[model samples]
Target: MKKTAYITGGSKGIGLGIAEALLKEGVSVAITARTQNDLVETEKHLKTIGDAEVLIIKSDVRNLADEEKAIQQVVDKWGGLDFCIANAGVGRFSPIDEMSAEDWNSVIDINLTGVFNTVKAAIPALKKSKGYIFTISSLAGTNFFENGAAYNASKFGVVGFSQAIMLDLRPYDIKVTTIMPGSVATYFNGHTPTDADAWKIQPEDIGQMVVDLIRMNPRTLPSKVEVRPSVPPSARK
Candidate 1:
């Protein structure tokens, strides 16, 4: 049987890119997102890739039950999950002075708590397969900046959470990795990905990195990876 992966936020952006790469490697993939419409569109697009199995579940990762249901469905379809990528996240930029409690809560709930839910749901199956758990954090996790208070807090929390889980699951032979990526050319935070953003990282770059991590020997586990554009426009400017 082909190895199976579950990706949250797989409807678009980096999550979708990872799914594409994994499918090309002949892995069965299951993705979860909030909208059925978006999930349908993603499923349709993934069909063009070949005969790889694709599962789409409409889920709001903020809900623990929904996360569990999504995982159960994948297990039922694929027999087991070999990888779980917690990529469901959202960001809203505003300085602390202007950031509302609701915005901060929303960011924390989805990005951090949602990951907790995803990991918890996948833990049992992962333990059985000695599977990998990958979290999509950001440079904001470690670097502070203005107008990014909520996003930064959530990502920082994610980094901490991911590392702690790494320790918790190490004895089980389950690998945990946190990927902290800098600016990427994606339709994120109101910025449309454009050719001009060529100097920035691309979603596919992150996806390829995931594949590389998977191919690594089990004796060596890279617990954290920090990725940024080799030539960031911010530095050039």
Candidate 2:
């Protein structure tokens, strides 16, 4: 039987990277996003990844109902889930004084509470399948910086929430890992990926890690992963 994965924000960047990687492993992937355009393009590229099925789901992770709908569609289509990657998030950089209520709430809603909704929605299915959960955090989860108040708060929340749930879910054999990645060359932060960004981590690099994590011995779990570009920006210059 083929493994199955549900990836929120799978239309682009890190989520898309993981979806492609899992597809090549023969895993059926259900990818969800709020935008239909991106999902359509991503599903097309995903089909070229390998001979696995791609389920396109138009969803907003911030909404619990939408998340539950995505999970149910996956279960109805593929039987059950083997993994859930909560990768939907956004970042806004500004000093605390300059940040708007909308900025803070949007970030926290999608980045932190969004994961809460995704995990809760997937729990029943995950327990049934003895599944894995991957939460895409950031280096900011542990590190702080100026103009990063909202982004930092959300990511920090992700690390804490994921670990707590890890403890709660072990008895059911559901593995949870929060992935904190440093500087990646992607459309994240509104920056277009380019050749000059080669020094940074690639989305595919993160994808490979997800595949490796799920392949680990069922007896062991590396619940937290912090990945960074081996070459620092100063060194890259």
Candidate 3:
């Protein structure tokens, strides 16, 4: 049977790349974003890639109800979900003293709580299918920097949460993995990707990794993975 996957924040960046990869592998994918226009455009783009079914859901990960509804829609259309990627996230960079309460809350709500909501909503279906869960974290989840208070906290929470859930879900044969990637070339944090980004890890690289993980033998589980570009700009002469 063909597998079905759902990705949060799937309109662009890493989410879009994962959707494309899965579609190529004949896995029906449902992508969710907060904007209907972006979702519609993504659906059109994904359709051109392969014949696999693509569903675009307009949802905000911060809302548990929205996530629950999105999961139901995918289940209704695809019968069962084999994979769920909690890739929805945001970055708010500022020193604690300089950060606004609103900015801090927005980062935590979307990056950390959002993962909780997505996984919570998808748990039942995944348990039934003995499926997989992928949570996107970052190197910053472990390494802190100046002006990264809010972003660091949220990502750190994600790492911890993902690990704990991995253990919790394992009893049901649900696989959970946390992918921590460094410096991907994506339109994240208001930065535009350019030719200069050629040295960085591409979003599709992460997508391909997901494909490989899913294809691995059921007896082996790589619970945590950290990915980095073989060479960074700083290493260049």
Compared with the true structure, all predictions reach lDDT values of: 0.92, 0.94, 0.95
Give the clashing residue pairs of candidate 3, or none.
Answer: none
1-237 per-residue lDDT for model 3 (tens digits) = 299999999999999989999999999999999999999988889999877899999999999999999999999998999999999999989888999999999999999999999999999999999999999999989988999999999999999999999999999999999999999999999999999999899989999999999999989999889999998978878
Candidate 2 accuracy as TM-score: 0.98
How large is the C-alpha RMSD of every model relative to the true structure? 1.2, 1.0, 0.8
> Which residue runs of candidate 2 sit more than 4 Å off their true CA positions?
none
The TM-score ranking, best first, is 3, 2, 1
Query: TM-score for each prediction?
Result: 0.97, 0.98, 0.99
Residue 204 accuracy (lDDT) in model 1? 86
**Model 3 TM-score?**
0.99
Judge candidate 3 at residue 234 and give its lDDT. 84
Q: How well is each residue in 117-227 modelled by candidate 1, as lDDT tens digits?
A: 999999999999999999999999999889988898899999999999999999999999999999888877667887898888888888899999999989998898999
Model 3 residue 131 CA deviation (Å) reads 0.4
Residue 78 shift from truth in candidate 1, angstroms: 0.9
Q: In model 2, what is the error at residue 200, expressed in angstroms?
A: 0.7
